[model samples]
Target: MLQLKLYYHAKPYLPWRFRMATRRFFAKRKRIRYSGSWPIDPPSGAVPDDWRGWPNGADFAFVLSHDVETQIGYNKLDELLEVEKQLGFRSVINFIPEGEYSVSERRIQELIERGFEVGVHGLYHDGKLYNNRATFESRAKRINRYLKQWGATGFRSPLMHHRLDWLHSLDIAYDSSTFDTDPFEPQPDGLGTIFPLWVERKIANPESLTANQENQISDRRSAISGGKSKKPNGYVELPYTLPQDSTLFLLLRESSNAIWKEKTAWIARQGGMVFLNTHPDYMDFKGNGNASSFPISYYADFLQHVKESYGGQYWHATPDRVASYFVGCGDR
Candidate 1:
């Protein structure tokens, strides 16, 4: 009621007031000056050039990331994995470390053996990482160590929740948490398209921390440093670009494969990365009793459509591979 009242009251003066306010805001802000430090001269050991180019033909890449949590049982994961295998696609599964749905080391190893990438999700799936820098850094380190132990090199933050500025501390080779579209589009500086962008890491000074906090510090600074420090090297960010499976099935109440196929085709023509994200917890047929059945059939059918439509032209790369390619490997 209060919001409605506020909206109604503001409607009268919105046209003039909103325009003037916007103009004043922009007019008062200083223009961002580039220091000629950007573009950083691509690295020597970057991934294969012409990575994005499907010289043979127009190729489509579908890198699936499954956010597996305790709420999603092992049986559901097995079923999802079966569907992926049927589609001939190896997906990257982001596993939580210490949550209800956390996977054991044995299970992680099994995923690795199965040609799937096991990326770090987080210690807990809570949305607390962005609460502050210190907490985020500590949690990142713990997650990184686990990934290292599991022989994984990719990461996707819990809930796709992130503060890109704070990601530099994580030692992972690539991060898959950036998004192209949201409830509204995300506005990141410089990189305008809904494509992968190399997250420029900044070197942190030891002197910046107190004695107690020094040991816990690592160099992952947020990508939004805005010239606060010199950029670090190697790490790349691959953002998820598309409606997540849960979003399609639950939020939009879409249970058809046609919508996904249409969306994928549209994104493919743009010649950019398209990340297909599905959660194991939501793919079950009857475990949760939330929906009528898991959307597994729809997902499998969607993959079949992609394969039939694109043929073998699409690059079947993992999240890490996608990141590496974006850095330089697959340059045109």
Candidate 2:
């Protein structure tokens, strides 16, 4: 913890090149160490117990989301939107409320008006939200305020750090801070399932909530089918099932989207959700290698592949609608 504190404290002073190189070194080691589990965790594909299956009998659910952490990323939203639009896809755009960049309500509304859902990323992109109970409680108030102000119903933590029980404080329909499997993250632990789980506010025992996700899911699932008690409400937890864009394009330096395509196919076969979280900050429309950005074509190609390979077989949805459907199904 001390090491992480020092690293984040000094992060502002370190050049991104130095940090990326340092991470790349460690990431490569982790990639080899966890090669069998990451990107494609076989057990994660298991359908949830008593699953009702996707809407309209679709093979799988698909959702795309982006986190804009800087002014540069915010500026590229339009270009990114156009690419997705051209491919007949829509996604959720999550903005940092108090990060290095400033986004106006008008801009957020513009995204909503353009057929995109808006969400609140962490208050700051810094990795401090879960530093301690007090810090999280304090920030939750502010985060909830932003969620209300922006009329957003989703929240994703920065760096994928999460405290599932702590998240119940926020006024949101769903939280996308967890992933199915990613050893590259600051919090290397994963939820171990591709399906979204309901984090019932009253049922989540403090002890289970702090444990690893497998145990957490076990305790929650037993409590799910029962009618929602007069117990306090809870929010849906959508664990992104695909590899993050930065982990693939920047840290691992992958040359193509083959990994994405391969994983998507597997998820489809298992009838699980193909939830993806990408960053516009690292998408290079210019095709220049600046800041280790990858060509936007990599993303566009993946979208095109989805369109061609699985046309009419998947339920393409925004994050909010996914959560709404899950809630309305009374499976919570």
Candidate 3:
């Protein structure tokens, strides 16, 4: 309601161009300014040698994901998969089961068969998932059923609207709907760290966190920066780094990979996870297009950059794979 009202009634009156320019300008400055914010504390014993690395000693981690919103984006999945495979990258493509187009179970199966991951986006892009407790609980049941049908354990909210407190009701292993920082989302407060942290069960309990994602605990206070947080992992949260393709390319009018490269460098140094969310509907087929057009190669180029710069220093895992690493049956 607030978001729709803002986009409908207020956007026309607001100087959005000025805002985007200011945001784009500060985006870089913040990136530079907060380079120190991450690796949140000085070298500590809790730091793992491969903080970013994964099983068998990979250095850093990257989980590339695509949110399919329209038929155009949905149509591009095969090509996207080919592009990723050619570059040795496998991504998760989320779909709206009964939204946009009738996304069939067969298509999702095809994605899995192609060695790609499939997850839920939302039933509709209408932004009502969190309207009220009853509405959310009702919709969650359908979402959970679809999740089981797809055999998925990951989710990213439609339009990036999320409520961490309500997530325990979601049966996913982890979520990729958050950002280290993004100014364009409906509730745009960024969580500051690129590292994957457990959404502690107590914290996510409905009584613990308000329905408002913008005013949640992590939003109000820094989740990192102390000695190590003793919070237990209920489910994992892999933070997306770099703004989404739509934000940088179309909104901010960027035309290059400079921001991504800078972010990748910082994340690598800090040994943090990079969970990038791109839309299949928004990217292009060529590798050399401007960011304003979101060339297909923009993502490919970033993958290449990761390969060239960090190489084996990072673990290229799926969302479930990363979460599975943290969740294991103890005392087996």
Give per-model TM-scores: 0.71, 0.90, 0.76
Candidate 2: segments with Cα more than 4 A from true spot: 203-231
lDDT of 3 at 280: 81
Error of 3 at 18 (Å): 14
lDDT of 2 at 72: 88
- For residues 202-246, what per-residue lDDT tens digits would candidate 2 score against the true structure? 653645544464443333333332333322357889999999999
Top model by lDDT, which number? 2
- The TM-score of predicted model 1 comes to 0.71
lDDT of 1 by residue, 185-282 (tens): 12222223345666654546645656544332223222222213323343677766666775556544555866567656666765655677877777
Residue 286 shift from truth in candidate 2, angstroms:
1.3
The per-model lDDT (C-alpha) reads: 0.61, 0.86, 0.69
Q: What pairs collide in candidate 3?
A: 53-59, 59-313, 60-313, 60-314, 60-315, 73-281, 255-291, 287-297
lDDT of 1 at 188: 25
Sort the predicted structures by lDDT, highest score first.
2, 3, 1
Model 1 residue runs over 4 Å out of place are 1-58, 184-192, 204-234, 286-289, 328-332
